[model samples]
Target: MRILASLQVRLPPSRLFAPTCPTRLKSFKPLFTSPNSDLPLDGDDDPDMTDPVKLAFARAEAYKRQKLQAQSQKLEASLSGNGGSNAALENPSSSANQGSRASQVSAPKGKPPEAEIIVGDPTKFENIRRRGEEPEKDDGETEAYRPKVKTWGVFPRPMNISKTYGGGKVIRPGDILETKEDKEAKEQRSRELVTAYKSKMGLDVDPKLIAECQKSLKDGNELMDRGRLNQALPFFEKVMKDMVFESELHGRAALQWSICLDSLQRSSEAKVMYKKLQNHPNPDVNTKARHFTFSFEAMEFMKVKSSYLSRTTGYEMYFDSFVDNKEAYTSAKTETKEAGETQILPYVVFLVSPLFVILLIAVRKSFML
Candidate 1:
């Protein structure tokens, strides 16, 4: 009976303990729970925690507190006398007062508070008027003074009419005007120049075809100017197809097309096209071609200049051969050095040879004696 009683004492009162502990935990849970019980305490888990409006309000409150602290510090500093502190104190105090005013202003019924304005003190401007009664001092130097020369007199400057629209010899009242014959001769000369240019460019195609080509070229140029190289390529290609080879227009078309290709990173094709222009009849075309080609070549040279071997071979093959050759050369050099070091000394050879010869001669003389 005692054993049974002891066992019962030693064992916990499970019913009572479980019920009481759980009751206590349940009671404390509400106290430890977050204010919004539906949302988690961790900021990342709560969707509304990062709301922009709430963040903005927090920032504004923080800024306001900082501004109030700064204003107080500025007021304190102003009470202390320091040489450069006067300007600094006035500026900060005015700014602080403006900040306080901004903070005190009420917002509209449904809107957030307006941003604060911190005004700096107005800049002090000193009056710096020169006295008219002051005597002017003249240094005895005349080199600094240069007299201005008149570029135009009674007649206006002559203008090159061909180079600019609305440019010609300026006429005053009663000036002799160009006669009809002179006008006709000038027009005839312009027509001949146009004809010659057309012949040079092989632009003697049908008017409709020429117009279409010109339009295409114009579109291509516009696209190129706007940095749309890919879009320009088709128009340029169309014009190039219609242009006769070696003609001035064809050379221009090809050059422009190659430039577009180069800009687009189609380097190999651009290089090939540029090479074709090397034989161009026009000196300008040939010069331009050489310039672009050399530029590309220079870029390529810089790219490969650091490499020990040419880039023509595969990396695997080149690297393997280089490593093998290097290793073989190093090993051969080491072996040769070791062999030279182990070689018999010239002094030892000279001493041994003389001693053996003397011994042989002494033995022969002793036998004869």
Candidate 2:
């Protein structure tokens, strides 16, 4: 019994000390699987997860984007070239830009502007060059709309002719009519045309008036060149009267009139005119007038001196009355100097006679001694 009990205890100890089989940890599986998942059937196999459709779609989209990018780069290179065209290259049309991007990307290269017909009607090509209009893309369709250009013409009608239910004659350019009434009407029309363009013709200088004034001025200058002051004065005066407000003409007329007056021996009137012109608006006229006044006054003063000298001497004057001379006083001065030389001859005779008497007394004393 002791042996049996020892065996039983040993047996229990052995059983307790015996090695046990380790249970393998259950393999963990994620609820969401990868594309390459390979699961078995009946939840006992891995799933086969390969998405060929999605891969094909992704590759196709990448290729399309790459092609578009390449096309855009080519267009950019063309536009950056030196010979690049400027035919609305930077198109401002919003409508054209909002259309299909493919159409915009496929737009053709434009030609140079110098090669285009810019002078003709753009509407014939179904184009309008005005601003604020929509632009169209080349979609292989003819344009259906274009703006029209208009030109206006002149349609002149007769003036001052009362209209009636009767027929009238038509007048044309360079038409010849053999009637006095027609000539009068033609002249009237010419006058009307002149009146219409009168302002543009320059009021102070009409063609005919300028011709007349120029002729008169030319004739007056010719006469003046010939030293005919009297004839020149009248022509210049007529010019002044024709154009009264012309200060140059007025001054010239006044100067010529004074010149003629002086030539006619009318010193008082010449002096009066010159003094009046001293306050003239033109500086040249005033200076000329002042010189003339001084000259006249000098002549008058010299005349008074000559008259005094002639009266005091009680001799016939050397100068004549009819001489309209400006240098007359200078000649009178030479004559007065000659007269003074003659008065010195009387003093010379008296001195010589006294010397002779002294010589006679000296000779008698010497002979008596």
Candidate 3:
């Protein structure tokens, strides 16, 4: 009250926002009054100077009363006379105002406009820096121009994957990636198969025959080492010419015979013996047969034989491996030579020129001495 008295003219929200037509509102009565409104605001003379809260309550009550009156009037018109058209005719301005308010309340908001895109000619580059500029009309090149296809990179979907050997092993198609367990199982199965085959053969060598074969093999090897191939021939033939194919002695004798035949320039016979030794029971004999040292004539025969065989066949890959390594080494050397050219700086020529002059002077001094 003291602050209001000091100001001499008190300011409140109700007076600033008072309705324009007070005379019409003054005659109206509100149905719902605020129970908390004990602010002496219902006074006839000081309506503009009322508390802001009281004024808000009064306005809300007035609005509710007006809505109720309008709805009741609409209902009365429908019951007594024509209908909605008559009600619209009776309150055209109010109906228009209500429509405008409804439209304002339910109005859709706007968004920024989308970017405009213009396609260009199919034959031309669309992203050229300068507009209307084009490439040359044609060149003498006969090759057709092909552009890389535009494609989206689709991420591979997650899969519930499993492997034969389990995780941490990188496998590719046709790779023989055997794990320890698989290898062991394979070895066991192979042993079983070999035992079964041997049992099926059912034939046994006599003790005397085995002893004689061993003695003959030793004598043949000793004769061969002494360069007496003709003398070794009879002993090796004695072991190889019999039904001792399953014995290690027979394989050894066959290998020695092939060697002797190759040394004697009997290449055709040597190749047959070597090929026969490939299926020997002894692993060492089979390996030696496949990878034996041969004379020039034998090697020539092998070349002819390999030409008839497929590149993936036995010993063909071994032949190609040496050629492949040579080619690779040659290519690497060529690349290194091309890349390692000595680069001499122009300034280093000055140092070299002085050294050459000193060298010439030293030579002249030596000649003078």
List candidate 3 segments past 4 Å from native. 1-203, 293-298, 301-369
- Specify the poorest-scoring 10-residue window by lDDT in model 3: 156-165
Over the full model, what C-alpha lDDT does candidate 3 score relative to the true structure? 0.65
**C-alpha local distance difference test of each model:** 0.65, 0.59, 0.65
Q: Please write out the lDDT profile of model 3 over residues 72-187, one tens digit for every residue.
A: 55644544565866776876765665665545544556976556455877458543434455644435342333223435524322232243226666789998887789899989
Model 1, position 122, has a per-residue lDDT of 30
Question: In model 1, which regions exceed 4 Å deviation?
Answer: 1-203, 304-369
lDDT of 1 by residue, 1-369 (tens): 878767743665443222111101111111122473321223323343445565556445544555565555554444444432674555655554656543444234476755644356434322222344343333534223222344444332233334344445678999767788988999999999998877766767787877887898889899999999999988978877887765665677788899998776677898998999998987898899999888878878788432134547666886777677464435788888887876757767877998999999999999999
Clashes of each: 0, 8, 0
Residue 82 lDDT, candidate 2, scale 0-100: 41
Better of 2 and 3 by lDDT: 3
User: lDDT, candidate 1, residue 91?
Assistant: 67
